[model samples]
Target chain A: MNDFLFRLFRNGETRLHELNYLFWECTTRCNLHCRHCGSDCTMGSRDKDMPLEDFLGALDTIPESHRPKGFTVVLTGGEPLLRPDITTIGREIKKRGFGWSMVSNGYFYDEKMHHLLMGAGMGALTISLDGLEDSHDWMRGHAGSFQRTVRAIKTASAQRGLNFDVVTCVNKRNIRELEEIHSTLESLGTPQWRLFTIIPIGRAASDPDMILSKEEMTRLMEFIALKRKNPSGKMVTTFSCEGYLGKWESQVRDTPFFCHAGINIASVLIDGRINACPNIDRDAFSEGNIYSDNFYEVWMNGFKRFRDRDWAKRGICTQCKQFRNCLGGGMHNWHGACEEPLTCHYSLLNAE
Target chain B: MKFFRNILKGAALTTALFVFQACYGTGPDFDPGIEMSFHVVSKQTGEAIPDITIMTRGGSESKWFEVGKTDSQGFAKIYGLDYKHNGIDFKFEGKGVTPKDTLINDFSKNFHEIRL
Candidate 1:
């Protein structure tokens, strides 16, 4: 039913005129060996951090007209703070009239780094804290990671007008502790708590235990809904925009499930491969490269596959009624090595 | 005076929960049924208003279910609703007060003060 409707309503080749967000994988080096590290980043990743000049040059390649006002370039990595010249990079990014922020593992992010990054015009920071001390330490594969992350949250919270949020990758082990995690974040004065289920990729692919079962996913949805329905005054809880959740669509998140990859979001990976979201397998989704392809041209003219969703109509998506709204869930859910639509909330939860 | 009493009741509820957690080392067990309390007052006079109808729907597909109407004290206690982990959309309608709609996604938050 959905397959026929999609084919009928599908329009001609769509193009992206401007980018709202750009993810620059500044460094591949990470301080922690997380159990579910999607990028498989390590303390000594062979892929060298891209030179600051390379990113700046790519930004320069995009014409001034194409760069939308308030467009932010998100600096992501195995751990962005691991880069020695992170402050300089932030400053450079700001100088180009673009807002800059980063996602970190929160191991090395302290009070000093928080103020330094903010001084460098850093707009926001997203830190990962999976569960309580024990659960967090286990997921991060470090003993004192939980303590440092809490300290970082405190530092960020203390900074007035500083925007920051703690993201937890919900796994089987920590799934039951969500209420405790929420209370902990609220106590820490954190502004937002973003929950995300682990994607079966990279190291996570090797450990099937990391993935949440259908029942757990439903509970996760209910938990998020409960949080939104009865908000914690100290903090706001939101589920990450990962997949289609049907009835839980606007209930759990601020907006319906829309895959922003290659549409409003794009990425320059650690290896300089241009893709949509960094989570998508780099090889399968690379539109072009920063070294060879013109950034603006590739963004505007290329990414035909990402912009169009007709091809995604195969598999379970063909039968799902919410296909028009979800468009086969996030690209990462169905793309790469995924044998099926592993993360469709409607199908997983059996929501009508 | 009534508003102050309602506020005290909410505080007492929180203190009781805290004491319960302190004793048991965990929060209360998950209850299948959700109970919500609303205290609606007039924005201009700060006086309790009555006969306000509170309606709810699980999602767009579900029909709106009128939770109940406010009483003489301008308070309504709604029970016997299954939250089922779905956020419920609530609509408040009454005479002389502006009708308002609020989405309640968190079941933990039960007490709502609406000035209409």
Candidate 2:
């Protein structure tokens, strides 16, 4: 109750005036090749790494009006940990009196990285963990990736101040092992597990095999429901609209800023180009380059394109009973998840 | 102590089971068994946080649930909670606020402070 209450009422962690978050793709270099990677993070580099000075300069360009109180900066990538000077990056971000966090594949996380992040005053570490052992290794396309991820979890779990959470991207292949992974998370003393329905874009968009059928998604929702009802489960499960059906299905859509579609969030690619979201095609939606253009203008203009979507002609979103509740589910999520009329998953579940 | 400063907001937010309630009633919907009261306040300003919704899913029925909004003193009394049979899983959301908080502490403790 204390933690939940804190999350509900607190505003200092969320100053009204400050820019909430900035998702910067630190680098495109990664060691693993996950089949469903939206960013297509490869073991080889795109050679589009943002220099430290350039990143800092762009950050500095953020007008003071945007950040009455310093904003949070989430360093992400094909694998942010791949950067040799990640600690220095963390330190520099912290020096500005702003929150610092990283989203990584957990391949490079070890005692050394832990020390560096802790010293640099990192606020959180969101590591990707899709499944248990064989399933995880299969998804990552590496033999020993599972063991390394376990090591990373253990290291992260032991940290006194540094916060950590597991991000499991759900897809067709590894959906069955979710319960087993949850059990493992509990045994390992993991605080939480983030279950994300895989979004089809980038590498995933090119492959039709990655998207989950409506039936598969329904089954997944049932599984999540049963898990939440269980009394002994320690880890909290945050399901998407498919998982938590009903009126709350619109909670995400109504709260636009929290999602990628909202103007508050922006993604910087490894090449310094900006996109509304990392999952979207960079070439097509590259809002502007962070190097040459101002970051604020690019974000406002690029996100306006999404905010002004035409739900009028776009799918079931136009006539659904709950059309007013969720504006076409959301521009990016609708585009990435569906090719047909965007029917409300909740409405379908209710009819059943 | 200011817990937000000590614990990461992301960690806390993810750990919470966020639920939004659109109705309120004390009729047959409640169990009249285990009851709990909560008071919410902002640590930064030391002021009560009113109109925050408090929700929980635990009771005698196969799928029992309860939801309510906080009063002016940031206080709300939740009744019909099946404390003996079900576990504690609550989500407290403030009105018009960007950040969402939940039952990360004991509601019976009377007062809880969140660093805003």
Q: Over 4 Å off in model 2, which ranges?
A: A1-18, A68-70, A206-209, A231-233, A240-260, A300-302, A310-313, A334-352, B1-116
Candidate 2 chain B — worst ten consecutive residues by lDDT sum? B21-30
Worst 10 residues of 1 chain A by lDDT: A8-17
lDDT of each residue in A1-352, candidate 1, tens digit only: 2434323322211232246578888988888989998889898999998999998888887777666544677888888898888877876776666766678888897755664565455666678898999999999999999999998887776554445678898999999899999998999889878888877778898897699888899899899999999986868788877777767766786644556577667788887788877888687779999999888778888887778887887777777677777788878776565456656667877754
**DockQ of every candidate structure:** 0.01, 0.02
lDDT of 2: 0.58
How would you encode candidate 2's per-residue C-alpha lDDT over A1-352 as one tens digit per residue?
A: 3323433433332232124466778888889998787667776876667888888877777766565332557787778888887766765665554566777778888765664455355656677787888878988889999989988887776654444577777777778787788888878777656565655555676666566676876676666656666625566554532222453333322211122233345666688887655655465456789878987766555454545444333555546654433445434454433443333455555555
lDDT of 2 at A217: 66
| TM-score of predicted chain A against the true chain A, for each candidate | 0.93, 0.83
Q: What do the candidate models score in CA lDDT, each in turn?
A: 0.72, 0.58
TM-score of chain B of 1: 0.64
How high a TM-score does candidate 1 get? 0.71
Name the candidate that leads on TM-score: 1
Off by over 4 Å in 1: A1-17, A337-339, B1-116
Q: Judge candidate 1 against the unseen true structure and give its global Cα lDDT, from 0 to 1.
A: 0.72
Report lDDT (Cα) of residue A307, candidate 1.
Answer: 83
By summed lDDT, the worst window of 10 consecutive residues in model 1 chain B runs over: B18-27
